[model samples]
Target: MADVARIAGVSSQTVSRVSNGFPGVNEETRQRVLSAMKELRYRPNSAARALKRGEFRTIGVITFTLSTTGNVRTLEAIATSAAQEGYAVTLLPVAVPTQDEVRGAFSRLGELAIDAAIVIMEVHLLDEARLSLPPHVKVVVADSDAGDRYTVVDTDQAGGTHDAVNHLLGLGHATVWHLAGPEESYAAQRRTGAWRAALEEAGQVPPPLVRGDWSAESGYHAGLLLAERPDCTAIFAANDQMALGLLRALNERGRKVPEDVSVVGFDDIAESSSFQPPLTTVHQDFAEVGRRCVEGVLHHVRENGLEHGTALVPTKLVVRASTAPPPRKVIPCS
Candidate 1:
């Protein structure tokens, strides 16, 4: 800051204001300060800035995996929002959240002087440890039922699944088969429930559940299994990656999409459109969810208190070539 101030011929306070994005600073001055900052390669000290601002202006993100399309999208949104808000983000990955890992993360978070934390929702194993974080540490859980104690920002996973299955059934398909994600995922369970309910509501017999780990490979394997069944027609995979695999498996067996088997996937990932046949999938507003979570936490932090409620972001189904009517005859197994 001092170097920037010297180079820009401005006071340290002016540099601080510019760095913190305080609004009263003139455009010219802000630009000059920024230029000086660039020329000198000056960086703001987040810890010192936190001390001055009386809030760390830092948020910790806890997520089990960034490997999935949905998780990555959500995290990207969160980071973008945090940056816009002049907050730094620290991403922490815990493939499996053990008590020790959770404890260690919280301890490290405490030492970082972060103002709040936002944890991506995991269906299981994280709640007990998450609950143990200091009450004063503001937290917002994303896409999980953390109850009334923790603010949650989530998409309508169940609702979206219901809509998808309902769409498939409305197309005159007898019953929709499900390829669910890993058992522990909240999304997988919620989607499974919605799929089953849609079937039950129509008085149709639901097919047995097939399990996958939210991977293209897993979806392919599950697809192979479904392809062997003569009755298989309309199928809904838990996510797009799996759906892609299913598409491959069906193709390999000489089954035509929509014409032979209709499919719907979750998380309309970026490449869904470019797939061999554009994928029909659910679209989640991750940016909206991330912004809401940040605002919710900031609201609590500003009030010197907290209130916990869940934010359920809406989802839409994008129908594409991947889904269509059943074939006239049951396709023989290749």
Candidate 2:
């Protein structure tokens, strides 16, 4: 430190400020300190600095998997938002969805150097370990039903699903068939409930449900079943990838989209617009959800308090070429 200070012709405190990324050091002087450190090959020890500051300003993100679109996008958003807030994100992935695995992640978190945590998995395990953490640990939950036990930030899953179902009904389809995600996902459950509610609101009976694992393969098989049904005029998939597979199945079965079978999907991912006929789907503000999660953690850390309530981000329907009024009835020859 002294060597760099002497070379840069600046005090050790000025050099320290530039290295730690603290403000109040002007640009020219900061540049000089950085040059000196580069020339001397001096590296600041982050752990020692964090101890001196009494806070790591890092958030631990505990999640299960990144195989799905929602998980990956949400995590990316969290990292971006955390960086904007002058903090860093560390991922703690749980290999399995078991309660023991979730609990073990949180247990290991206690030994980590993070000042806060943003949990991105099922809250059933978190609920079970409510009192496991010390009083200083602050938490923000994403994509789970924590039930007011923790600050929650998530998309408007139910409302988006309801809009999707009702959109098909409004376009003259008698009923919309649903291809749902796995039973274990809270997001899938919310969408399923909303689909049922939308049908009941319009005084129509919902068709039977087909379950999928949020994959194109699952959706392809489910599409085959729907293809066999003559009255399957409209289908709503839980995600865009499933919609892609469903579209492929419908095409192979000679069912023309919007001409014979209209389709709607949730999560208007980037590639959705380039699908064979393009997709008409719901758009979720995943970036906004991530930003709110970081904000929730920051609020708790800075204010010495947390809001034990769920924060909802809005969603909307994005109409495209894939949906239209149900196909006209064909007149039978006498």
Candidate number with greatest TM-score: 2
Clashes per candidate, residues 3 or more apart or on different chains? 0, 0
TM-score for all models, in order of appearance? 0.87, 0.91
**Residues 74-155, candidate 1, lDDT per residue (tens digit)?**
8888899889987889888876766667667777888877888888866567545344456667888887767577878898
Which candidate leads in lDDT?
2
What are the Cα lDDT values of the candidates? 0.85, 0.87
Model 1 root mean square deviation, Cα atoms: 3.6
| Global lDDT of model 2 | 0.87
Per-candidate RMSD vs. true structure? Answer: 3.6, 3.1
Model 1, residue 174: displacement in angstroms?
0.5
Total clashes in model 1, counting residue pairs 3 or more apart in sequence or in different chains: 0
lDDT of 2 by residue, 1-334 (tens): 8899999999999988888788999889988899999999999987887899878889999998888999999999999999999898889998876667766777787678888998886423433544233445688889988746777898999989988998999999988899998887889888988998999999989889999888988989999988878788999999998999999999999989989999999999999999989999999999999999999999988897986878989999999999999878832224
Compute the lDDT of residue 101 as modeled in candidate 2: 75
